[model samples]
Target: MLSIENSKKRVTIHDVAAAAGVSISTASKALNNTGRVGIETRERVKRVSVEIGFRPNALARGLLSKRSFTIGLLTNDTYGRFTLPLMAGVAEALVDHGVSVFLCAIEDDPAMGQIHVEAMLDKQVDGIIATGKRIDRSLPVDLSNLPVPVVYAFTEGRADSVSFRSDDGQGAKLAVEWLSRIGRRRIVHLTGPEAFFSVRERAAAYSAATAHKEPVLYGVWSESWGHEAVARIWSAPGEKPDALFCGNDQIARGAVDALREHGIKVPEEVSVVGFDNWEIVAAQTRPPLTTVDMELKELGRQAGLTVLALAEGRPVEPGVRKLPCRLVVRQSCGGQPSEK
Candidate 1:
């Protein structure tokens, strides 16, 4: 039988141990699954704690274990275009373990980044995950010798450290192959600047996938660039490309709009594919884009777990991990709406 007054009071580990007929140390070990304890005794303590609504004090646990059960997420993607989805994944992965995430956006300011890093260190964060707008660039602040473990996601990292990013080459190949599969013989690649590592990688893959038959248009990552590229190609072309594989959804949207203005029908006379299946841009496009998804959320989930493993003293091989990308089909590609 439960007493109303007792239920209203906080159930401490001491009360749990008392109810389970175990010592305080034993109860702690059982609840945390730390020290070796008899299986039956551990089960009994856990059952009793649940029945009594025993919730361990996070601060007390952190003090005793020298672990804050918190992670710091540092990013320069102030727009939140990439950071927000990745943050959600990190939070989802850590929430089950009673871990919290602290987010800091520095926006390319070294001083601000250093300040945020110091603050997170002051808070005794268990680990830190550094992310950014581009994978070729590093954060403004130095994170090389931090006391806490560091994991890099969607950003450049030290050669000796662990990092995660999408396989841009594979993603580009997927896009090109899809265009070829739908009987589109001539496919043009409209992408961002050649200086960008991702742009170069995707361009190489696009060339190989198309047998070096199509032109690779290097331009800025903007809808205006997409529109201008279309105008240039159509004006001085032998035969207009039957398909356009863009660097991003924005470019794809612009190309679609230009094609529409030129009295061209998408998926009927021309097919368009894009990278970065950003819903805000991809879904809202006139014909909805068939694009490549980098799966940033899954990348974040893996990065979060890797950092947690490091914080827990678990061994993890350090290297750049390139997760695979998938193609999302929509009305623009002359295919049934589906995700691959």
Candidate 2:
């Protein structure tokens, strides 16, 4: 065991070797059961190593093994703002498995994602994790054609490659269900701009959420657009919608602002819902906004795991690896039952 008083004298394979009365090579071979070492000696060395605090140096092992142990992160974000924590979860999951990481942010252009994907082919990345909406499925997906696995985060891969994505339909369903649970039958949906895949799916899901009902849906991607949509809804209705659903939290935030400005009370008079949990910004609202938790971190983690598999000449998973969305109840939505 490590001595509590001697923090400087950290345990090493050499210390285990000395205690076991064996050369470093013997200790290494014994620990890894490599280089034709005897089983009994290996067992004794392992036992002694376990007796103290000894850990194999993963970097050294990775170096010797010629496995770059690095996964390339491809994205078009100008800066790795949201991508950072998401990548953190994926990296933590990979590093424990002795995988290293390489990250590159492409310019905000769709072409940049394509260019980066080609660039990664020349680099020593074992796999790729493409993030953000700007990533063109057509560009980096050719890597899927290679022996190295490729994965995508918060983005979609081309049809030519196996891709993993959150089940946006499920997320949409969850948002609607939560609103339904709180007596928000007369709901309104405000979405982001129509260019992105998520925007389209979320729109479909939102519209579907109001099937057989008179609920209204306004498709727009920005807060300004959300404000406009809300304004339009109020102009028509005497009182306005009982609930609101947004494509993303940004739009939801704007919707809430517009509703409050119009002398409408959220949840009590009108309930609001949004996708993408985004707790940092959502919680700070005067009345914390009730939103759906898309679990982006877990989505990134799964994307990474699938990509690792593809890099190994293995079959990549087909179909949506649908992630679940949670209803984050806050002050913005009413907990009471509805009349209509």
Candidate 3:
């Protein structure tokens, strides 16, 4: 069914052979890095192949290796806020390894999760990376007994599975430290509901860093809550805070708006730092925002590599692994823009 034009456009091993000034068998051996060949000649052949944009047939390569060269990413993050960057990291990590990904959006549906799992199994995916919107919660379906290797990223899983997450406490500490370094004292912590484990971890870190005298404020993860918290904190004006550490960007943005209404200048009057350096929210703030980034993409890259290692019969220690978070500096906290 291949058209003549398409057939002509396809680059074959013969083309590599011709370009590399080698026989077809020699080209194949050089390309696969198998059989005896001169080192210089092999390098030349590879360079030429790359220059010509030659790509081997993946189906044929998979057939020889008995690996479908595919992976499955199962997530309950329907909004893709967490999953999108994670998926990009996974795909980028595996592209050179000749593996593709199948994304399954389960969206808190047990039946849907089961269906996707079964489908990935049917396709013989080498492994699966289970991720979600939050690290505190697990996906609806069971992954403990799956046939393939499973790695958890930004989500809870079985106790013994290899997992990756951002160091929430450390990230919070970073934010607090940044505020202190900028000579802002009287810091106050405003965060989400107490039910989430991250909220507690962040609050504890904030307390340790500041020996926080003021009580921690817990509310819904929303801009409205941020606005309300600001109002309450300013109501009793006995020595107001010079800095506000928000749990997320939404709350920070709301706090900034409320501060504006109160005629308080940002950074100059009260430096504001937020978590989850969500670009859309943080970068668009009046002076931009200084926030902590969980590095979810890097977590995904590590998770991808770990799952692939397991699939390739390599041993990896199983337990929860906490990756580091980074502080992205912007104008909100009187910091220069991040170079990276």
Best by lDDT: 1
**lDDT per residue (tens digit) for residues 1-340 in model 1:** 9666755777899999999999999999999898999999999999999999998888887887889999999999999999998998999999998789999999778988899999999988999999998999999999988998999999999999999999999999999988888889999999999999999999999999999997799999888888998888888948899999999998998999899988889979889998999999899998899999999999889999999999999999999999999999998989566645
Which tens-of-lDDT digit does each residue in 134-242 have in candidate 3?
Answer: 8889999988788899999999978888999999999999999999988988899999998999999999999999986767899989999989999998897589999
Tell me each candidate's TM-score.
0.89, 0.78, 0.86
User: Which structure is stronger by TM-score: 1 or 3?
Assistant: 1
User: Considering TM-score, which of the candidate structures 1 and 2 is the better prediction for this target?
Assistant: 1
Candidates 1 and 2 compared by lDDT, better number: 1
Model 2, span 19-87: residue lDDT tens:
999999999999887897788888999999999979987567656764567788876554665577668
Q: What is candidate 3's CA lDDT for residue 192?
A: 94
Whole-model lDDT, candidate 1?
Answer: 0.92
Off by over 4 Å in 3: 1-31, 35-57, 335-340
Candidate 3 achieves a global lDDT of: 0.91
Clashing pairs in 3: none
Residue 5 in model 2: lDDT: 83
